[model samples]
Target: MNHPMVVGIDGSAHSSAAADWAAREAALRGVPLHLVHASPPLPGNAVPPPAADRLRHLGEQMLARTVADLGDRHPHLEMRGEQSDDSPATALLAAARTAGLLVVGTRGTGGFDALAVGSVALRMAMAAPCPVVLVPRQPAGAFGDGVPAARDVTQVVVGFDAHHPVSETADFAFSAAEARGAGLRVVMAWALPAESVSPRTPAVTEEDRATWEDQEVAQLSDALRAWREKYPRVTIRPDVVLLHPAEALLNASRGAQLLVVGRRTDPQAVDGRLGFVAHGVLHHARCPVAVVPHVD
Candidate 1:
């Protein structure tokens, strides 16, 4: 049996959009969809028992409504809704333990209007046991139905670090592309050494830059060779950019259906902050971003 895809819900428009995206993906993978709503326990003497009960009821109502709506759209997709008494991050993480992929809104009801991503969403992306997909809200007046515009050319873009390639990350990207029947764009960014610009350093000519670019392209190809063999049907485009990783990824995400990046996880580390590249694209990527956790 295929592991179900889990999505967090909070009665917000953003969460609704996430649920929609998750439903489509779940259907594509021939897996069930699970919707989870977390209602934190009220503090002692913080609110009357009646109000607390009302809050819990509201949470259940939200989940039921979302599940019903999604079921109507995806008639054949199996789905289940649950309400938990733990914090948002805790409940979602627990659900993700047995899930193949976890999905969440980029921002929820807790964040400020100006914040691009919510604290809980960021935390989940960095620490979830399974790969997490952060779905951004549809832009105003862009997709009135909460669905993105269908593109003639579908593509999945992944940021590849040739220096430290992770097979798990590659696997996720290739699988996603294969499932969607979309082309995979493997992007690798490189920059000239800072010392090369020093006054005492010899001037680097155009030929030197060309050679460096060629080397980076070779590295990217070598890293993806095995993946290409494993997923023979996935059409791939290798892109080598002379820019920052975040910028390269954001640019490549213009018409992409999904953007994938890797995050290094340390079991012993207390902090779960995301890496610079993952953080940047999570905030500005035009399409859904998937953060795949791996141990380097």
Candidate 2:
């Protein structure tokens, strides 16, 4: 079942931007927007007895204010607010089970520098049950203070691994593009064959390079064949790049509405949850980044 888009707000500039970003996305998806704020009760003896009430009260006010602001801006979009006592990550993760997409700030009240993507964002990106979008503190012109023309943001860039492409991720990208009448650019990064990269190997010939490129192109085509059939109306641009996957995606994301990447849902993994490529893009991508987890 489709679920409402959820955003976590903490009365910070980044989270405020996240709320606005979520409002726009909810409007695009034609779904409800749920505003959630987590103000975990302080440990005993840490503050005045009334501090918990004050914190919760503050969170409620923030939620109310956000709801009112977004309600005025997006008349057709449904909006509601709630406060959770769980940690930010815990609160959002539980909400994720019922959310189609979880939106969060690149940082929260804790991040001092503009470039710092906080721990909660990292945790949710790795463990959320649904797709998660990390809206940066400083967003693009379209996602900035003024609501620019949506048509100006024309593309959703998705990184695809031809050998083991994730269908859910591909579909997510297609759906996002379709929602905005934007194009989908599927990017694949490859390198030289093992034989060519080995020590003492002769320099690759033009014929071998041509063969490799053709093979990579074919792989990309085959990987996306079903998606193309499913989303015939969505314009698809398949990009096979020679750069590292993260760098290639970062470069492609310059003018995109969103960069979509996949996280492996491996139960046994202890750390490095988002993986190298995804983690890199999340840290560096210029546009909003979506981390869609898949059972790879």
Candidate 3:
């Protein structure tokens, strides 16, 4: 059996939007949908027993309601729910171990109102074993009314680094595009060498800039050759831009249904922080962002 698509729920509007997105995704993938709600333990005397009990009860009720609502919408899809005493990140990380895809809202209930991405969502994107999809809340009436707007024409945008290509990241993007029957937009950004830009150095002519851009285009095409064969059905659009990686990706995400980027997992790196490009895209990309972890 395929691993289920797991999503963290916390009775927040963002989480509700995430659940809706996950339900549609689970149905598309023909896999089970697992909902998790975390109610972390409080310090001694932080809350009275009765109050804690009430909180737990409310969490359970929220889980049941979400499950039931999704079931009603996706009657044929397999669904289940779990309430964990662990913190949100801990619970979701454990769930990700056995999940095909882990999903969560961009901002949950506990975070500051101004935060575009919540702490738990960021942590999961960096540390989860599987691909993490962070769904941002859509405009009012975008969901929960009826059918979502058709996304058939919307492409799946993925940031590609030809110099350090990660197969897992490309594979995930290709598969996602294939599943959605959408085109794949591969964005690669490049800049002029620092030395070439210095005043002491000879001015780089238009021909030189064109040659460098061509090289980047060629490298990007070469990197995507295998993925093209793997997912022939997905129309590929290679975009080599003269802009920052984050800016290029954010621009491509304007009408995209999903934006995919890589998070290099360094075993020795104790920080466990997302790479610069991924972090920036996650903060500003309007579309749902998928952070696929891979070893460089």
Candidate 4:
């Protein structure tokens, strides 16, 4: 449809906010906004009876209302609305295949619980055809009486694993930073082994603690040096603590607007297993996370 942004809309207030945001983004980018509402189909074995007919009618009404409401606010925008019989996640992905960006609400009116990322949002983010923006549900009257400010900066805080290539992540992170006119922070977290700490020793000698700390900082410096040019404005931060990388990132994200991580490139042994660190952060990080698939 040549839309710059494709946004999924349900009846939730969060969805309305997302539509508003998408409409503004489209206007800024000088492109059309495509609105989609997907409805799951009835069982294939079921007959096309009165109940099935009623369900279809309801779906149409919902789509119509959503389009009308959003269109009212953005009368100058070129908006296209559609209702289709497909799972919400699948349908949105299909519609976004040709879009420049996809915007989704963190929660929806669907039966799924809204603690973390909604299922559809997560699925689309993991395998979307383009970049996806996950917007949280703001409090009542948050976007009242005026349009909120546009996000001029897109903070991409990347967690680089020691064994992984920092250059790949840094490349993409810099692109995002430059595109949004934001500064990038390249972070390296070092996990101290339990063996390093002694139960009997109350105060360790300065020489001993300094030895371990130096090694950790040196490793982080080497990584930063390799990608120094890509992000000249990048801030290098190192953490040497007794915590898992995933847990450390979750806490570090308090100051970040977006968290960036690379897709696992670990070779699955005969058993075929993925890296636990990537899985952990993806499912639990408080802020929206961007998983950059391996560069071919």
Lowest summed-lDDT stretch of 10 residues in model 1? 139-148
Give all TM-scores, in the order shown: 0.93, 0.92, 0.92, 0.66
Comparing 2 and 3 on lDDT, the stronger one: 3
Clashing pairs in 2: none
lDDT of 2 by residue, 1-296 (tens): 26899999999988998999999999988889999999987887887768868878878887898899999999999988989999898899889889999999998988557555799999999888889999887665344346553433578899999998888898899999988899998999999887785567668888888899899999999888899889889999999988899999987877688889998897676332889999898888657899998885
Candidate 2 overall Cα lDDT vs. reference? 0.86
Per-residue lDDT tens digits for candidate 3, residues 178-210, read: 888889899999999787777676689898899
Runs of candidate 3 with Cα error greater than 4 angstroms are 139-153, 200-202, 268-271
Q: What number of clashing residue pairs does each candidate have, in the order they appear? A: 0, 0, 0, 0
RMSD of each: 2.8, 3.1, 3.3, 6.1
Off by over 4 Å in 1: 139-153
The RMSD (Cα, Å) of candidate 3 is: 3.3
Lowest lDDT 10-residue stretch of candidate 3 = 139-148
Model 1: per-residue Cα lDDT over 25-111, one tens digit each: 999999999999999879898989999999999999889999999999999999999899999999999999999999999989887
Report the alpha-carbon TM-score of model 2 versus the true structure.
0.92
Model 4, residue 211: distance off in Å is 3.9
TM-score of 1: 0.93
Question: Model 4 over residues 1-296: C-alpha lDDT tens digits?
Answer: 14468989887866876777777767656688888887776788585777777877787897788777767877888888888788888888888768877888877886456455676766665666566666656421233335542332245567776546655556666655555556666566664545666777655567877786688767767766756665566654455543577877666654455667665333332111224665676556545555554532
Name the runs in model 4 displaced over 4 angstroms: 1-5, 17-33, 44-79, 99-101, 112-114, 129-133, 139-155, 166-168, 193-210, 225-228, 231-242, 265-275, 282-284
